[model samples]
Target chain A: MEYRGAPQATLVDLLDRVLERGLVLDADIVICLAGVPLIGLRLRAALAGMETMTKYGLMQDWDREVRAGAQSLQKGAALLAGQAVQPGLH
Target chain B: MMEDRSQGQVQEQARPEGAGGEAGLYVYCIGPALGGGCCGVTGIEGREVDAVVHRGLSALVHPCPVQPYQTANLEVTASWVQAHHRVVEAAWKQWGTVLPLSFNTIIRPEGGLSAADALRMWLEHEEGALQAKLDALRGKAEYSFQVFWDPVVIGRQVAEASPDVKRLEEEVQSKPRGLAYMYRQRLEKLLREGMEARAAQECRELYGRVARCAERVHVSRPKEGQEGQVMLLNLSCLVSTGMVAALEAEADGLSGREGFSVRFVGPFPPYSFC
Candidate 1:
């Protein structure tokens, strides 16, 4: 196959996996900067789908809140329709 | 515990200054022994970089302040992440195969051990597992494939094919405005479900096609927030370095099909595999 020479990885993909996946060791010492350990902030909220974030155990709380909100919205719509709640969405 | 710390702050304070001027180690990757030619790659924040060898393994590292790289701002974080990957890429280019470490992996001296001693101790402890991973991944690389379809086009196709949806459309045209609204809602929901079912089938077919060239596959969830584009698959595959070309060719073939947008990337260190 004549390879079209496409660029293999981009910064988004690299950043997504670099800290989230890969071989990590537990024997790490903490570095304190201004009385706080200088461990980096992982901005996972800015990347990944809800499914991916949940798979990696990053955003379960947010996921729960979203689900709950959706459920309530559905219930409110059903009430507005003047109908008893159906067993499930059709 | 290591997995839990992935997103949390690494708050390890060094026991009161026992060794002055000692810097923490920022690790990039570990690999089998290699001949002495410096990679000359810079670490995050332009630190000097080199390797620390013990037994038969070499750890590519650079000395930095004991603190881990952290920034609330994303732009700076991106640069840090980019710099981290650059080192790994350089190591892979020079060393052939490396066991890549995740970003922000910093090891400081703990339990009365200096930073170098701590690293050496960990290397000794994990030597067997590390070596096995390294050997297994020697000639393999990770590739990413993403498949997307235009939702509008899919909805149109679903509308054309589903007789129920077509009947509803006619009912809406005939009914008064109030009742017609409910029919429209039903039709919209039906079309959405139809599109999802079609997408699921397409995803299975694409995965089967791509899996032919893969040694191992890791399926990731599609990122949210595409207004009209429906993602079908987001996956990473570990393939023999030799098969990367074939995978890209397959991706090209998939992209050529109507309404499908395929993105293929990599030859990267097998981050998912590791």
Candidate 2:
């Protein structure tokens, strides 16, 4: 039950605050980046390494695609290294 | 065309101050105005952090091109976000309370005004609202509470507690092979429904317990958990600094339960509450 202080807060925690929460202003005077897709995409890519994305059910298809690509690359490396490919490696 | 001309004029009038020629102010958070001095903290992209005061309120900001801080590079974007939080956290420490702005909140010049002037003007206009929020948030901070339940453990508990599930289990054991398969399917469905009901009940109880120790409660969508655990509740609580210990004790009580675990993090800058 001991709470983690701010310094111990994870990147996901920070993202939840800075990206999603915080005081919103009128769009007229502030550079409104709220709906910009590219930034969202990039932030998701950055968070792909974290468990928060999977926890939130975000980018699952993309995550599978990346994992599939990585497995193929690993197989290729194994072939080049003259090692028997493991069946369960996928 | 006449329409295009008017659109162009509008753009000209709203000419983004920081995007091209003039630098706009990227505001981190707002707080009670302190005497003129550097925040002694660096902000996004190592920009010098300072305050723009209007009446009783101050916005901690750094000058930047009016363009939003955007990048395809993950590392760069993460660094920027972390840096933004650092400045806000610093301000929270210095001011005791603040209204933190979201990332990439750049204030641009409008019409013929300078970026600073535009910021000051907006502050003047929003002074009462800003001061009220700051006052309300004084002596308070935000804490995140996530409750994760081990599905296997909870499922077992449900199976033991529900008469319908237990009757099905015994009936399945007594039936022929083919009949048992169908009965097993029904049992699974029944168990699943019971689990869902239990989850909702647990969440409601936990919410009530935490609310007692918080000034405000924000319920967020629960996320999936690792290791076959399911998140039962995701909450952000605005707690008086003095009540943090009580909140933690409540969380500890929940975590001590058989099938549940809790992630308690924060003393954050009341980001969710603001």
On lDDT, the candidate that comes out on top is 2
Calculate candidate 2's fnat: 0.39
Per residue, candidate 1 scores C-alpha lDDT tens digits across B1-274 of 3443343323322223335444688788888878564477787768677788889888888876565666443445656777778888788778778888877677887888877778888889989988998889888988888776665666678889999999999889999989999998898888867766676667767787888889988887654213334446778899997887788788888777666677687778888888
Q: How much lDDT does each candidate structure score?
A: 0.68, 0.74
Query: What TM-score does each prediction get for chain A alone?
Result: 0.31, 0.35
How much DockQ does model 1 earn?
0.18
lDDT of 2 by residue, B49-154 (tens): 9788888888888877777766543445557788989988888888889998888888888888877888888999888888989999999999998887776778
* Model 2 alpha-carbon drift over 4 Å, by segment: A1-7, A33-38, A45-90, B1-19
Worst 10 residues of 1 chain B by lDDT: B8-17
List where candidate 1 sits over 4 angstroms from the true fold: A1-8, A28-90, B1-21, B225-227
TM-score of chain B of each: 0.88, 0.91
